[model samples]
Target: MKGFFSLPGERLFHVATLSALGFLLLFFVGIISSLATYTDWRQFFSILFSKEILFAIRLTLFTSTMATIISMVFAVPAAYAISKTNFRGKNIVDTILDLPIVISPIALGAALFVFFNTSLGRALEGNLMRFVFEVPGIVLAQFTIISALAVRLLKATFDSINPRYERVGRTLGYTKIKVFFKVTLPLARNGLIAASILTWARAVGEFGATVTVAGAMKMKTETLPIAIFLNLAQAEVERAIAVVFVLVAIAVIALVILRRFTSRRQTS
Candidate 1:
């Protein structure tokens, strides 16, 4: 991926851009360092090991995983369809799908909150299940926020794949479904994994909508992000810092896993 334009002062441009990148890294590192400096190691460990924090950690993992799975189920097919098929109003549909990704999660959460008050929402709550301010609402909120992101990523993956493989399978009498399962999916393994990782990471950090839809109930709806927010609200800065460290740790682990997976795939 070359730059769009070659600059007359190309060497100077490269030096300036590299300096900018270095500065960005330093800025973030300083932020993380401040988190560490805010509290003692023992206090951080104590806060992290507390029952409430443990529960929040567990809830965060479970909800994010559920959201990621649900997102992938719908996203894969939607992305595949959008990438492989040309249909009427596709552009319209595509744009509509992108709304969830572009819209503020807080607004999305608020909308979901409002939806549960409507007749349909009330009926679903009465007959099917409850969502608003519930644990399930956390999952729903996460799904609403990250599903479109998953679609965007998987669509790009599908777009990059050569359709020739599927065509070749069809020539040998494979049904479209068969070709997809056997041929296309294998090629999309890397993309599927990458999208899942990103979606799950986003879901884990989701706050505005989850807080809006689930409410900030300690021990119940308190995900890691919610715990952080709750602590910060009560001026429990040390506790909040601990949770921030946990989030940073999760992010670092995710990045390392992604990097390793991508490297191995490339090498293999």
Candidate 2:
């Protein structure tokens, strides 16, 4: 009697899992099907090679890469400090670090826009590079939104690393900086790579902040996501779909590379 009940429960669990997976698979299949509906190879190739899209591709790649690299430069050290040290108001600091992830990107962008009106922001704007409705705004928006994610991912990576290795290096007469570069960082290399891939993907796909800060100025501030939005708004379905495919391709490539790297790291 007990075995019979257990068998039914197990079957129910399996069916539930399969149903959830089926829904996810169906969603992606629907997107791919819609993309495939534009079977006109000529139209597809024309849109793909269009100068606007080519420029968007270049800008998206450049800003996203720059944001990820800049984020990692700060994230690595911040993550290590957050993971390895204990200080006053640490919880507050952690919450502040996570503010970008918690808040909506559009709201964050709006906040940034409002900030620029302040005295300090205005002073910085006058002396430093202009950001409002500019190319630099794209980078700033991406960096603001993506850096938090980078820090969060790296903190997890640093947490997983054994602290004893750092202590071992210190005992061998290495300074904290030396120990971190030699011991902690080498072990966290795979995590860093994975974080960079994820950060770049997030940056590339960021629309709300980018749109709000940079203003979708077609050939000027337009990124792939913004381009899709602009095309869709103008009822250019084929062009929008083509751009969507490009975004999907980039995302799939990044995910595939990250997965292979993670698998190799685990095996090694």
Candidate 3:
């Protein structure tokens, strides 16, 4: 009679939502407890301030920022093209762009490694770029993984923008390129910021691909995640967990900044 137990359904929905929130709270508490176990403040500071860890932190931030910039450079055009056009093999193109997201990062890195062994790759390595087991390899690996995700995010942003606005700009004698710059991009500013934040965060945390292509060599190719791995391999659990906490802190700060930026944009 009355919509098939609507009140009970609403109660069930609330229960499910509360249970999910409780699980998330448990997850955070578990991480906090694990970090709390390493309360040797002196030892933690020593590990955190050590030269190797400092180098790793610097390298991670630099490479991630570079990768994020490179990803956006390509992602913006790719996303807009995909969102605004219907082309032959459009679905195929989209899938290929998304392959990095779908494929394992390890496999992607392996493919890069294999590519460098090929004739063209060897030519590029000999002349222009040397990616395998080098600093460039780290950037390339991070870029490869992050760009796909950036494209996905940017495409959603572009898709959210109304086509009629561009049409109106055209009727006002603005070209497509002009309209894109003057109207669409301004409208999508918040989305662009969000995408950049997400891409940078993912790039900073990337490990499998970077390790495979860059080969984690102490202060040379050691990113934060690789530093954690190397430390754990040597039974330096405290150092490893300290790096983990550093990464957690970085993520928390980035998320807080993103939330504030989004909130301000919404209010404005």
| CA lDDT of each prediction against the hidden true structure | 0.92, 0.92, 0.92
Q: Tens-digit lDDT track for model 1 on 1-268?
A: 4763667568788899999999999999998898777888877788889999999999999999999999999999999999999999999999999999889999999999999999999999999888887899999999999999999999998998889989999999999999999999999898888889989999999999999999999999999999999999999999988899889999998988888767766765
Name the lDDT value of residue 201 in candidate 1: 95
TM-score, predicted candidate 3 vs. hidden true structure = 0.94
Better by TM-score, candidate 3 or 2: 2
Query: lDDT per residue, candidate 2, 1-268, as tens digits?
Result: 5675597888998999999999999998897887887746778989999999999999999999988998999999999889989999999999999999989999999988988889988898899988989988999999999999999999999999888988999999999989988999999999999999999999999999889888989999999999999999999988988898899999999999999878977886
**Where does candidate 1 have its weakest 10-residue lDDT segment?**
1-10
Q: TM-score for model 2?
A: 0.96
TM-score for each model: 0.94, 0.96, 0.94
TM-score for candidate 1, please give it. 0.94
- Expressed as tens digits, the lDDT of each residue in 48-106 for candidate 3 is 99999999999999999999999999999899999999999999999999899999999
